[model samples]
Target: MASSTSYPSYKQLKEDFVSNLSGGTVSEIALVCAVAPVVSLLWSTLQARQSFFKPYTTLGFVVDFLLNVGALLLSVTLYSAVPILLNLLLLTAALFIYALPPNLSRKKPRLLPDAKSRAAASAGSLGVLSTKPFLTNYRGNMMVVTCICILAVDFRLFPRRFAKVETWGTSLMDMGVGSFVFSAGVVAARPVLKERADNKYIPLGQRLVKSLRHSLPLLVLGLVRFLSVKGLDYAEHVTEYGVHWNFFFTLGFLPPFVALFQSALRVIPSYAGLAVLLGVVYQIVLESTSLKSYILVGPRTDLISMNREGIFSFFGYLAIFLAGQDTGMIVLPRTLKARKSGSQWTMLLTLAAWSLGWMVLYHLSTTYKYGAGLTVSRRLANLPYILWVVASNTALVSGFGFVDAIFFPAFYNAHDSKTEKEAYEASTSRILRSYNRNGLVIFLLANLLTGLVNMTVPTLDVSPVATMGILVAYMAVVTATAVGLDMYNISIKL
Candidate 1:
């Protein structure tokens, strides 16, 4: 286990902050908070309202350009205080927009759903609210935004010191991307899973064929990116897993494992059950043998360490995905009852309690076993990390759900209670929608561009300010191009 590091003193923190600001760290943070959030939130709102793909008006683009320019200036100039304030401002704006009532001028007044009807139907028992699997766009949008943010920092566009391995509340890039893939798999499988019966018969050969067919595209992208980066001979860093293992390798492998297990199991196990079983088995095997040493340092271990984290950890990733599937099963029910505010509050509180409990359990278990605080190892992706990821994700979902519940009436203001249902098939967030439509293209584009930037520009030799500017510009171009392509209904999928 990694030893704990001390928190920095106020004087040290101030010095670090000043140094970072002078070196242009604020610009990256500013871009993440200001530009990324705006894109994410605006696109999500437009998606919810089915107003995306409306031609980009000259006035709208002009306003957006000005806003981004102003945000950049504030970041570069103020450096310290402004970024924090701007983040708060962005959070406020997001909440305001979320809580904003429907356009009453253009639409008729819509009332909140009658909680009394639901409550009476329950006959004094706690009413069951069958919610959609995940809160749809919010989780996916957040994942993309986070991936962008993590990449921004990881590529040295942000201060390199911020990537320090020991920082408190650090979200490692590997882990972030891994979690995103796990969530994506879970969400993607929902359509098939919704109707999958426990007794359904499926030949193993058919499952393998299906898995391979689905995995082939991902495999091609993985090989392309791997060869391209190595072929170009870009600067390579240790990155924990060394140079060969990447997320693509993990992506390429997970589908087959998922297919094999799903085809073999009678019914999918519960999230909690799978997590415990996988984690315990992994830890036991790891503890009982020298597999760790073999994978990490023994001769010619490259084949087994496909994710650069060792082979066992892939099992943990699969478990995480399965947990996500369980989450879908719990939330995505056809017989959804409109929930009252009180019931919604109770649900939110329940989720918070679960997160808190898991957090405490994670810390206690790790401390008892290892005599150290739980370290989230992307390399191993052990028990504590799984618990942490699940808890954090649930907390995020519940918090978003709570907010929507608080403003339920506003969300329903466009139609009557009967008509105001979750729009399962309606998402028009150009940024996220485009990314979703062409996941491989976007990922490959980012990698290809990163390689190009490294080769063409003296990235490591540049000032922090220049680096931030380059990264923001690069990301803006990628995302904007995606949005534009999506506007034309173009998806470059395999």
Candidate 2:
């Protein structure tokens, strides 16, 4: 093993390597986004053939791991070289499975009730169970992609175009943090959208306290990470989130801040409008003031100055979260209703329209050079960046939704009748369920493993083959940890 002191300081070397590179084209990044859902659809198709594949058994879990996570790993590493072709192959497999006899699909397990009973139950419990499997799939897939990219970006096998851009452009990794925030907002919207049974409202102060209580873990994690990085002399990308601020702190503050506006979130008819308003206002502030320059090139003197990127970008992330909440409001109920009716075309089309609309807005914001006059900047999380995050995440979720509707409609609709354990076994990939169950743990583990790898190996100098081997082993360990926790029914929630 190479000694840490033998090479140039890891911090300077890593920062210099990643700095100042423009990201890939939007079309290419979008294609990369499609790979996850497409591969997931193929996995769902295989699960549907339970008679042949014997799904819900231990054997089935192994297959699920291989097909879902394994395929996703390939998509981001090797198959990334030919994303279009990989997507084509996955889509072809899914279509072939779809064309099989309807009888070939898994029969409704004995635990679930009939369609009518399940529908009534689902309607009655909608408030309690607003989350559907497809949402789980979306969040899990996004987590997988993020986990892969966080470490993979250091390797030669990972395409430079997909790495995070220094200032302003779209890339797979650029979407990671924004998408994670957006996904959190999606799930968080459930409670916001749920109507009070007695028409009673919780007081804003109480809500703030509760939100803060929930966010406490994130704040602690942020502090721990900050101390660890500095104490251990870990490689620090100061511009990414600033010297002291990090994603955990950004995540921590959002819930409490949003909680302060619980009344507004409820009273406003259009959360999307609220999101746009926030984004536009922030963009105006960035354009008309010196804040942009301060964030981009200003000297760091005090605490605020040192963490300018994380602090200023909080508003943009908040905007992205609000946008996601708005989308969740639209999609969650529709997804449940569609489960009963086996029709999701209207919902799918609505998501498509929203995605296209956001994309057009993003284009106008970047192209016309009128207002904001900015390209997408993850560093600043400005208007264009917010729009891009919303657009791409919505599109990715839409793709996952389409896969569920077309490839495994019966599984979602009928599986609700199963017991909790049975449902876990009978539904889509268990690996995804595991990932969903232990997302925070997986992320923490990935971060630790990333640090370990950097300390032990010359990640920047590794050959492509060695990079692939390291990535595969890293992902395997992460995946196994997720599965093991879930196997023991251990949920390490924050």
Name the regions of candidate 1 deviating beyond 4 angstroms: 1-87, 92-103, 108-136, 146-151, 154-157, 161-170, 197-201, 263-268, 305-310, 337-354, 368-374, 408-429, 492-494
Which candidate leads the pack in lDDT? 2
| CA lDDT, every model vs. true structure | 0.52, 0.80
| Minimal lDDT window, size 10, model 2 | 415-424
TM-score of each: 0.70, 0.89
| Candidate 1 lDDT by residue in tens digits, 344-405 | 45555666676576567566645756544545555566666676566555555555455454
Query: Candidate 2's error at 482, in angstroms?
Result: 1.1
Clashes of each: 1, 1
Overall local distance difference test of candidate 2: 0.80
> Using alpha carbons, what is the TM-score of model 2?
0.89
lDDT of 2 by residue, 1-494 (tens): 86677666767888777664688888888887888888777877766653434535677666776676777778778888788998898889878977787554456544444765765576443333435567788998888888888898877778878888888787888888899999988888777656443466778888998898879999999999999889988876798989999899999999987787567765666778888988999999998999899999999999999999999999999999989988887676635545555545677788889988888888878885554367899999999999999998898888888877665555445433433334434445677888888998899999999989988998989997888788879988999999899889999989
